[model samples]
Target chain A: MAAPASFLFKGKFLPLVLLLPQLIITGVFFFWPAFQAVYQSFLREDAFGLSSQFVGFENFTDVLSDPTWLQSFGRTIFFSTAVAGLALSVALFLAVQADKQIRASTTFKTMLIWPYAVAPAVAAVLWLFMFHPNIGLFGRMLNAAGIPWDYKLNGDQAMLLVIIASAWKQVSYNFIFFLAGLQAIPRSVLEAAAIDGAKPMRRFWTVVFPLLSPTAFFLLVVNLTYAFFDTFGVIHSITQGGPGKATETLIYRVYTDGVMNLNLGTSAAQSVILMIMVIALTMVQFRFIERKVHY
Target chain B: MLEKRSLWPYLWLGIGVLIFAFPIYITVIGSTHDISTIGRGDVPLLPGGHGVENYSAAWAGGAGRFTTTPAAVMLVNSLLMAVLIAAGKIAISLTSAYAVVFFRFPFRMLAFWLIFITLMLPVEVRIIPTFQVMVNLDMTNSMAGLVVPLIASATATLLFRQFFLTIPPEYVEAAKIDGAGPMRFFKDVVLPLSVTNIAALFVILFIYGWNQYLWPLLIVNDRSLETIVVGLTKMIGTGDAQNEWNVIMATAVMALLPPVAVVVLMQRWFIKGLVETEK
Candidate 1:
């Protein structure tokens, strides 16, 4: 969307001019911080904010080589992908199903949003109880059903539990977006598909699903970013990346490193690498998904 | 040929709602239980005999914790800081968005992209440098340190500007014709007319501000300076000493009230905001 030449410089300067103070604040606070992180990633450090060897890429290598670091990075990627992929699929499925309902729409809508209204910490703690296995509703139900499940004993089980919990919280958010997307599709198009003898599965696959691709793609990137970084609270409450390094993620590593270990330099370097991966992935999404995104 | 109505849809919707709403039910049930009952995992559906006990424990605990340490202070502090930051954000975003969407200016496109770019640069990547700024300002452990950095949310500005763009700027022109200054014009004409958007924006900002734990965790490590989110973490406690589940749930329930209030009170406006942007 190129700016029209008629509107380019004519009477546009005033708005742009007014936005300058905001730009300055953002530049100093946002741009400067990002630049500094990248720059610091290259520097050497020790006790008392001291060092100047300019190690260039050595930090990246050293950070990656550590077994704890490598394992955590892999786990972080898995955690994020699982959360995002599962959440997106379920949300899309629910949205499609809900859109077909002539009755119970308002009830479903209200119930769906109620979970999201709960604060993150509260939701996480609540889940911790449900997944407790000793004294949770799910625990009791599973016990009654004669299926014994414990996330504490098995790291793999813990990972799956966290993923499920994260996805459960996020599915509502994605449903909100997907519901909006579903509503945006013209009702006439669906009616036409029905008249054309498209079966339920066929109509969804050929028409509604394709039409929702833009929204799905948008959510894919957003969900990935969120699951990767923003889920520390859930992790902190549920497992604290515990039962060994099984649940440890990059963001958790950053928190433990920067806050607990007080190794600001190493943490900052990790943050820099994490940022680069995110940016590169986002750029790829822009380059490819932007073109592939169906309107 | 097919009807849009389907029994399958309603069945699925009902189940999905159950899956989503189950956690809250668990929390509310947990809150109404006694410590022994909660620990026993015997928290049942209806309000148990422990409702008064739990609520009183949380309130009494609040006074004890607030005086002896920072948890109570943190809650009050978080409220104060979040409210201030929220107000600043609305003011800053409104003025800035109005400037760009309603006014003519050079590098207008550049300003818009700059806003978008902030959305690009993940704050995880930028935390150290931001903390560095705070440290340099000698604002560490201060309420100002907890806030000032957040006054520039790109997402909020973009949302505000998008809504502002649809505000029929002929009103601004008419106000101008009546010799209204920019400030007066914005205060009297634009803002009053956009109460719905403003309310929606407030809810969004308040939740974001309230739920923020990471930044608060990083900058304000002192227990005395903790927000409710960070304070909640402290309840889990040290090695060998088991955390009190009933009290924790009580705190969690309390922490949750603000966001719930925000959502319920402004739900109509919030849906309107979404509807407007979707259009």
Candidate 2:
């Protein structure tokens, strides 16, 4: 960890005053809300919010026992895995190409990176426009070829559409990180491998891949977090977790239950579950960092 | 670097570029065509003559069948929200980081950890309660509601602290010898030195604030407070045949331009900010 500066200003109230805005915002917005989610998880209330009873872990039990919630949890894992896998592999491939001693590499990088600016919802719209089944170009082509290809009606198709859209939006971010990772690899190591009769592909596998593992692992955690939480916009815009809950993930279920259905107790329980998942992911990342330091 | 004369790199890169660019290409081309043309489902590769007409219709409003706010109003609201969020985050993070690094105070570690813990609690996981907090504060549908709660950034504060720690103790000693106060030293020495970090951070945060979806969607039912990202998705509605594909595509294009322009234009700083803040 980075240390504080050795020499410091001697101020009592000034430091507290300086820290107040962030503290207050964090207290009221971040901590309080998070605490509320945890608190509400244990309480069951009427739909009208008229009365509530403290049921220790009943809400958690209810959420855990619900087959739909279990399926959503399983679906979240599958969806997040697909998104992270596709995004990471595509970005790694493109980053490898960009890392080459080729012409117009900067131009290629610029083009690849601009998609990072597209909002997840906007990204969904672009993909939806392309695959909208009626007003879509590829969607029209698929139908004309006698393939049944309406995502709105088909569950698997809707799942595939969301995965593509979400991964497409993420490739740029992973590309940036992967490119930086590739560039950071020492040239001397690659040169030494080349002198030992290693071909480009072999060098990449033996020398480069291992060197980039730290980044690859880092991107994996980041991408999973993104797929879990950040893809809400993509799902919201394309399919509101529809076609009989085919595309619904844990995050989507929480929104549907809490905001749309007003099942506060169950929704709060799910939120607590997701919060634990995030904390777990973060701790895993920190542990990896610690291991890297030891190495 | 080992150099090889080959088309393999170019070929792979060309294909990658196409995959990344095709959706946007379709969006741009579709925006230029009329509703009937796009609705027919097989949009042409080239731009159509209805570009100005589609853009103007979407810009002014009433192009689509849905009851809607104008693209112009939503764009302005998004800009205001984005600016406030970026500026607010930078301001608060800078001051708080400055305090933690410069001064010795009681409960300093406690204050720092409180800020740090927020990194785990994204607005996504805590949506309902945050909305409840907003409702309780009477901040719903206001600009403050959209901006303030989101501005307390752990990453930004940590980044600033990381940067601040690198400032030489000699500089602080000299400032102290010259009888400079903490605020004065910060304004003169710290702020000027932090320009690059701030500019880079502004690029990331601006895009963040501009692209916010679920939060704005929940809190701002008011048409006047609609942000472009949420507004653009709303424009698409349920994807029925009666929708105005041309106008919707045009608004999507308009919504994308500012943040994309910022990223493309400030490519260097954006990359630096992104990599640094994540670290």
Candidate 3:
């Protein structure tokens, strides 16, 4: 894969020159900081940056023993699962509906896809507006209906709100992929199932669902990654991991610990852990998931 | 074609559309109302007569009392950040991809993998250390500080590599036979062919740049350098007290419009680019 059998440029210096800008930027911004994170994880540093001491694996041990850190890890897993599950199912449902030939299908597609363009922060703000207990439309209606929906005070409600908002932003992306996957299926296969007297529901379960598994699985990983790292803005703007840290994910904890609290060692350890998780997840995506995906 | 037609599809599509559109519709309507009306705890579902007043207030004077940076400055900052990040990513990625794909050089694969590894290190994970580096470099509160570090990822380069790999070797051969240098062939031949991919990437990257919250929030303490997305979030305050819902909603609308318009206008390219790039 590195060297394809193609006519190539002969000058060695030109290629180096061409790659210089990216290499320089990556070296300074990517490699340097990543190295710093790894190095700092093992060293305990004061907030004022006046003193430091080498403490091997102490920060990691501290993070592992910390209840809040462990809770955040568990919460991040739960959050990612909920986000990926909700976003995938909703998107797949809509994609299946949109796959049918109907009037204004294009219009529905257009409406559904625009939210992908909305920033996560903005998405949070929009949802917050509708869900604000006092002045929000749904919040008022929910309270009127006596369901007692106040995300601000209720932990579960706060989690649900952030989940819904994050999942809402992701649904559009999942929908596009599912639609593409659905369209890629050969019509003949569905027709064969239809002729054999398979009902639409049964056909979907056995034939369509199995065929769409690759896309579904692909989206599951993507959505999980999004929920893990990309939903920071949603969590930040909506709950700020508030109501007593109910919505705090690993990424948000990293931010709060490092930037807000100035616990450099713990945050650096968390950063290293987060980096490993992402690398592991990305490897799964590239190695296992890509191999299984048919197309 | 043999399937029976039912109202089920329409019902599902209608529900889906409604669920997605309701927030945006309500946001628009809310933006058109006065703060007093919105603050009364029961927002009208219809557009109110205060659209111009609310939007102009948000545009010129900013929203909440705490955030005095107007929407105009924030919008400009967001636009500049988005455009520069998009353009910068594309430019560097294109050249780097060209080098990796077209030339056989030492450590070529090593360079490619080095860049590829950065994908795993999102700015969020290494936020503290990266911030430390920025401070050491004295890059905080500048556009370069905001844009450069974020563009170090290899997604765009990988996308360009994927696109470049599909171009027939004959193009290179033809250009070579005609005495065209690598740069010339890249400029005249390869660049033209990659236009659609670039446009599609522009839409995605523009949104990515515009939506950046955490990095900007950390790096730029100067209110003047705030992007609209971050500025809008700051405008919300901790609670409803002294918070202008009308102006906030209007700012949300303003924040969302440009990217949404780009996606809607370039729907085809955006979709194509998204599907292809993810591969």
* Candidate 2 segments exceeding 4 Å error: A1-6, B1-3, B64-66
Candidate 1, overall lDDT? 0.72
DockQ head-to-head 1 vs 2, winner: 2
Error of 3 at B233 (Å): 0.6
| lDDT (Cα, tens digit) per residue for candidate 2, span B46-67 | 9999999988888887564645
In terms of lDDT, the best-performing candidate is 2
Positional deviation of residue A244's Cα in model 2 after best superposition, in angstroms = 1.2
Report the C-alpha lDDT of model 1 over B123-190, residue by residue, as the tens digit.
Answer: 66567777787787687897877777777767678777777666665666667667776667777977
lDDT tens string, model 3, A181-241?
9999999999999999999899999999999988887788889889998899998888889
Query: lDDT (0-100) at residue B128 of candidate 2?
Result: 89
lDDT of each: 0.72, 0.92, 0.90
In terms of DockQ, the best-performing candidate is 3
Separate DockQ for every predicted complex? 0.47, 0.78, 0.79
Ranking by lDDT: 2, 3, 1
Q: At residue B278, what lDDT does model 2 achieve?
A: 85
